[model samples]
Target: MSTLTAVNPLTTLERRALQSISTSDGNMLIVAADQRNSMKAVIKDAPNGSDAITREELIEVKADLVRHLANHGPAILLDPEVAVPYVVDEGVIARDTALVVGLDASGAETVDGLKYTRFVPGVTPRTVRDLGGGVAKMLYYTRPDRQGTDSRIFAEMRDLIAECNAEGVLLIVELLTYQLEGESDEDYAAAFAGLVADGAALAVRAGAKILKLQYPGSAEASAAVTEAAQGVPWAVLSAGVDHETFIGQVATAVANGASGAMAGRSLWKDSLSYDATLREELLTGRALPRLRELADAVDGRRG
Candidate 1:
């Protein structure tokens, strides 16, 4: 939806936003507690009487989440600007981490006055630079090619990403890579490559700042190390029902090219009946002793 004639790299604020991403400092994890996963944390006290969490309860939990994350040092991403206050009510998110939109990175409509946003439509780097678009970011989507088109959807997205670059917007491509299982590991890896190649092409042609690449489904073996953060920042699942299932996903993210992960359900769901501190521990990977150990090590480095 951009109307720029020439393309360019992201602007200053855009770059700052992109560089602000961290999986641990509490800036980019999906933390809203009203949805299905309740961001993995149960909502024992929703004042609104609806599934959507209330500000008061969020205020209480957010502080605890931040403290837990500070000790662990990771950023979490939540949706709806209304929740922005929870992250920065006291200027915490503004001071400690980066936040990305946690909306439906797959749609552009609204429900119950809630805009189910997937991408930031009608915006570009020029808009951010010339217009009042400000330091806005975008979320890209992936999955089985919809609308009967080919995987060329990536290329089409590449062009749009170019426009977003010129408009000073950050385009983060989400990873709905494959149908999980029934495919070979090599095929899955190639799919990830294809996704990255699309992002790299867009960056080279124009200059988008971030690549929200998700990992391959068939092989959840790459996301936990330097390999995961290879091309750009990527998002990983909060967790799967199984233990090895989630760890494998994190491992793949690290192996491919991901600096951090944004997780929800796995952390919160299991903590439904637990106390806030214990819930915090679970979300920070304490439930899984190995994960908690890893978090402590990461925190040690930052300290």
Candidate 2:
């Protein structure tokens, strides 16, 4: 498809109407698009009836996927910069224009640990750069506990962000807290908020603008979001599970003073039927009504 068609999508834009929502500084609502974060996919022989996928073919798939997502309406595009450029180099699919979001996180570490040098080897040195002169941002995901700050990992993040500089790259962060699967929603939200605040503070001091952190669950979630975002220019809340859940969550985030949101599975998990309907709503300005309703529901309910 032509770049014009991909971006303008003459048909309609209910999904693209995202900017009309709420914003801070320059709020951005994005959708995370990645089937796998495996830096290098371990190729394997496929069973009969399966088509072989060459590295070039995989690059094409990645590019096309990006194009498809770009049409969905996102001010910021989240993905590992290193992997994205690989596809661009192949010319299979070149979404040369996008706001880059870089995330560096690990499994068993604390907030401070991420600030140091110890990190999952594969996710080190999170960096962001300009793609087609648009905007670029980077964020280092880390745990909050001082013990969690691994020397190697944090050092990598510190160096990478500092080197990226301004004019081309914007770096911020998101911190995950609690065992996502085991903690209570409230506790989980508290942990997430505390960690987000810690990371947000660090990122801003170094020139980062947005903090893409966990979704605070309820009022506490709102408070955490508010607290973490204190003095920060902007923030993007993590995506939730479904449209309803995401809307509610986003509403809370906005109330907590978030500028926009970054959603993934929650936005694309629906059938094509839903996409068409949602798209139309955005183009016609009809979704604003619904957004208001959502905002009402989300108030004081961030967890």
Model 2 segments beyond 4 Å from truth?
Answer: 1-25, 34-58, 72-83, 86-97, 101-139, 147-157, 178-190, 205-207, 237-240, 269-303
Worst 10 residues of 2 by lDDT: 1-10
lDDT of 1: 0.43
- RMSD to truth, every model: 8.6, 10.5
Candidate 1's C-alpha runs over 4 A off are: 1-16, 23-37, 44-55, 103-141, 144-169, 177-209, 218-235, 239-244, 256-260, 272-303
Residue 274 lDDT, candidate 2, scale 0-100: 16
lDDT (0 to 1) per candidate = 0.43, 0.43
Point to the candidate with the largest TM-score: 2
lDDT tens per residue, model 2, 56-97:
544543444344443334333444533455544554333333
